[model samples]
Target: MRGVVLHAPGDVRVDHREDPTIIEPTDALLHVSATCVCGSDLWPYRGIETVDGPSPMGHEYVGVVEAVGDEVTTISPGQFVVGSFFASDNCCANCRAGYQSACRHRVPMGSLGTQAEWVRVPLADGTLVPTPRVPPDDLVPSLLAASDVLGTGWFGALAAHAGPGRTVVVVGDGAVGLLAVLAARQLGAERIVAMSRHEPRQRLATEFGATDIVTERGDEGVARIRELTDGLGAHSVVEAVGTQESMMQAIRSTRPGGHVGYVGVAHGVTLPGEELFYSHVHLHGGPAPVRRFLPQLIDLILDRVIDPGRVFDLTLPLDEAAEGYRAMDERRAIKALLVP
Candidate 1:
């Protein structure tokens, strides 16, 4: 099989690799139908996250089950499924509490490399969510999105406490951020503010139910949000970018008693204890427990109630994944879909 391997910064290649097989009774082998490049994948590609060697890349995936271990009963071979970036034994205490991302037996799927013809999924019965029916070709992208970005965005909205009569602000205009805007609307946020300077993203934000767009950055951006909210700041703020500036902007743009849901992979970020003490804003975020929301998100996509797949502005064959990475790094694409 062929898979993406990150040899170094700006060096992604499709190389031959050994195929995957079920090594554990709880594991399942999948014939990956669709996979994509994630914003987080750029961390290693850009050297923000150090690479010690050629590492396997990609996590988001939707595929058909080709085989399952003896212990995996619920998910049978031939079923189409979507799974989270983090695989979990959904029966764990944390999973029971709706935090599958922190399950006792959690495993990062990226390490298994889903960007290939086939991949192995651990905790198969508890981690993979089967679709109602075999999804059509057109729905593959949307189902694939649910595997990660859509679920993450939904988690962001939930963490931020977005609901009716509340004003919500979303920082970062990437795919996850845009989907966060969509999630906020679906969660009943009365007003959605998306901070973005790019026209394409701003347009998608509006289409996704953004009531306003703020193109400013740093303090100015916070001021704009404050001005729009009558100096009280937003009722909830979603921080989709993990940068120090974006995090500060999210904290500053929320009211004293509001909540901030940060989903961006934090890199070189440090929050001053004193500042946080005075801000009085609630902050909570980490890798999204996507498995917790996979069922609902999958239903939404299957019902055609939401079209989050619009986040993928570029598509490429699995062999051309390097170009997909370049497109995203160069800001020429919001997200890239890789068809295997």
Candidate 2:
């Protein structure tokens, strides 16, 4: 098998690797069909996180089952499946409470490297959701989105309580943020304001259901959001960037009692306790429990209610994984999908 590995900061390579096998009675080996680079991958690719040696990269994936361990009865060989980025034992307390990402026996998808010809999925019954069948080629990207960005965007919308008659403002213009706008609209948000300056992202935001686009930064961003909302800030705000600036923009753009749902992989961030205390904004974020929403999202994708896969503006062969990373890092592409 061949997979993508991050040898060190700025060094990503595709090399031959041993194929994964069923390691646990509950595990399953998947023949990876599609995978994509995530914004989070940029953290290490740009040297923000220390990369000691070659580490498996990527979490988003959609594939077919090649083999299943003894205890896996729900899925079987030849079945196509979509999995959450985080593997979980669906029977756990947190999972039962709809927090699968924090399941007592949760595992990250990166540990097995989905950016490969094949990989093993832990907790098969809990982690993998079998689709109705192998989908058409165009639907592959939407299935892949279920593993990360779309799910995260849905989580952000849910956290912010986006719904009927609410005005929602989205912070950041990355795949997740753009999808957040789409999710809000799908949830019946009356007004969706997207704060972005990038032309490509702005266009995508509108296509995805943004009612208005605000090209401003910092205080100016907040002011535009407020002005659009009749002097009050948005009823809900989704923060899809992990940086302090983006966080502040989310908080400032939301009403005092509004919720700020942040889903960006947080980096170099600390909030002043006093500020939050007086702001009265509800802040909720962490690794999104995408497993909890997989079933519904898959249904939506299959039904064509949403086309979240439109985020992948660039596609490359598996061998060209390094170039995909470079394009994203250079902001030449919003996201890159890799096919094996």
Candidate 3:
């Protein structure tokens, strides 16, 4: 089989690799139909996250079940499914509490790689969510987004306590951030402010339900958020970029008692103790428990309540994944969907 491999920083290739098989009774093998590049993947491609030699890339995926281990139940061959980066046992204590991302028996699916013609998925019964039936080709991209970005953004909205009569601020314009704007609207927030500088992203954010677009950065961005909220700051803020500036901007943009749901993959971020301690803002977020929301998100996509797939402005064959990575790294594409 052919799969994407990152040999080093800025070097990605689709190379021949051994095919996957069920190594555990809880595992299932998927004939991948669609997969895509993630913002997190750029961390390694840009050398910010070390690439230990050639590493298999891609995690966001949707596919058809080709086979399942003996222990697997509720999932069978011929079913179409979507799964996230982390596979978890839905019965675990954390999973039961709705934090499947932190499930005691969690498995990082990236270790198995989904950017290929086939991939192995563990915790099949708990990790993968089947669609109502085999969906049409046109629905694949949206279903694939639910596997990661859509769920992540929804988690961001929930974490920030976005709901009726509240003003929400989203502090990133990437796919996840853009979708966070979408999530805020669906959650019933009275106002949605999307922080973005790019005109194309600004337009998409507006389309996603952002009532205001703040193109400023740093303190200026926070000021704009404050101005829009009548100097009290926003009622809630979603920090979708995991940098020092973005995080602080989120914190500073929220009212004293508001919340900040941070979903960006944190890299070298540190908080000033005194500042954070006095901010009086509620902070919540981590790798999203995507499995917890997969069922609902899948339903929404199928029902056409949301269209998160619009974030994928570029699509490529699995063999051209290197260009997909390059396009995202250079900001030429919001997100790139890879067809296997």
Winner on TM-score between 1 and 2 is 1
lDDT of each: 0.95, 0.92, 0.93
Return the TM-score for candidate 1, rounded to 2 decimals. Answer: 0.99
The alpha-carbon deviation from the true structure for residue 219 of candidate 1, after best TM-score superposition, in angstroms, is 0.5
> Which residue pairs clash in candidate 2?
none
Please provide, for model 1 over 1-340, each residue's C-alpha lDDT reduced to its tens digit, 9 standing for 90 to 100: 9999999999999999899999999999999999999999999999999988999999999999999999998999999999999999999899999999999999999999999999999999999999978999999999999999999999999999999999999999999999999999999999999999999999999999999999998999999999999999999999999999999999999999999999998999999999999999999998999999999999999999999999999999999999999999999999999998
Best by lDDT: 1
Q: List ranges where model 3 is wrong by over 4 Å.
A: none
RMSD of each: 0.6, 0.9, 0.7
Q: Candidate 2, which ten residues in sequence have the lowest lDDT sum?
A: 49-58
Please provide, for model 2 over 30-54, each residue's C-alpha lDDT reduced to its tens digit, 9 standing for 90 to 100: 9999999999999999889987678
- Which residue ranges in model 2 land beyond 4 Å of their true spot? none
TM-scores across all candidates?
0.99, 0.98, 0.99
Better of 1 and 2 by lDDT: 1
